[model samples]
Target: MPAEPLATVVGLLRDKFDLALPETSTELWHGHPVWLDDDLPVAGFKAYPTFVTVLFWRGQAITDHSGKLNASGSAEMSEYKLKSVDDFDSDLFDVWLQQVRELEAA
Candidate 1:
């Protein structure tokens, strides 16, 4: 982990982090990188054999679902994933940021 694992994940989250509050931070949760706001996690990430897990918290908060949040490939996570760097889409990242905002607000 030349850069930290969370750092790597946050680098990915960087695509969606701006819209959320500054209180949001990253940590290791069950050996995964997790993002938190006011102590409540907004998202988490993990890299498996063939994919990655991008777990969005406040998962219970999203009421009006629109936009893209994918959990494809073999990460097998219950939340969304981007699997590869090529999958990082700004529009979808914006959606994830929106979810982060909603979570922080709660």
Candidate 2:
């Protein structure tokens, strides 16, 4: 489990995403929490000194209609930086999660 507020955020994310992708598995990857599709990493979260970052491994391919992803000029990855759980947007996150699953399936 994560520490304090992070745990709350993680719980919310897990609950929401698990319902959408029942087969997804979560584990610590390089000390960061990650949701996996079989052996492939679909999404992950890392707690930084400045903020918590949620990562989409193949996010570059997914169209963010909400324009929430922080591009940071990365090619195959994108991330959302949140200072707290209140910054987490469930609807937008779901759209990204669904798109990633479809991309992985393809």
Candidate 3:
């Protein structure tokens, strides 16, 4: 993938995450930016060759009526893949973030 598009998507995601997850700590874990709630992985994003994947650690437990999140990895993990900026949905993302926070707290 080209750097420009990737950068734009990453910038948007980072800014949104920063604003929505103010109470969480963000760090580069395994070379990917991840938000942690007291050392527990809450959410994160990883850039792949064809797309960017936004992940919720306990997403399987989240109530996503939109059906955008796809089960990923093990445990309760889920992911939404974006091929470009156009694929990003702010409203859905916001809702997911809120659910992720609540799940983390629980």
The model with the greatest lDDT is 3
lDDT per residue (tens digit) for residues 2-95 in model 1: 2344345547565456345456777788886677876766677676655666666555445436434544335432366555566666665676
State in Å the error of residue 19, model 1.
Answer: 7.2
> TM-score per candidate, in order?
0.63, 0.81, 0.93
Which window of ten consecutive residues has the lowest lDDT sum in model 2? 66-75
For every model shown, the clashing-pair count is 2, 0, 0
Which residue runs does candidate 2 get wrong by more than 4 Å? 1-4, 72-75
TM-score of 2: 0.81
Scanning candidate 1 in windows of ten residues, the lowest lDDT window is 69-78
lDDT string for model 3 (2-96, tens) is 37687789899999999989999999988999999999889999998778999888989888899989999878899999998998888988998
Ranking according to lDDT, highest score first: 3, 2, 1
Candidate 2 lDDT, tens digit per residue, 1-106? Answer: 5576777787777677677666788888888778788778888877765467788888888899878787644468888887778888888888888898898888
- CA RMSD of all predictions: 5.4, 2.2, 1.5
Q: Worst 10-residue stretch by lDDT in candidate 3?
A: 1-10
Instruction: Tell me the lDDT of candidate 2.
Output: 0.79
Candidate lDDT scores, in order, read 0.59, 0.79, 0.88
Q: Name the better of 1 and 3 by lDDT.
A: 3
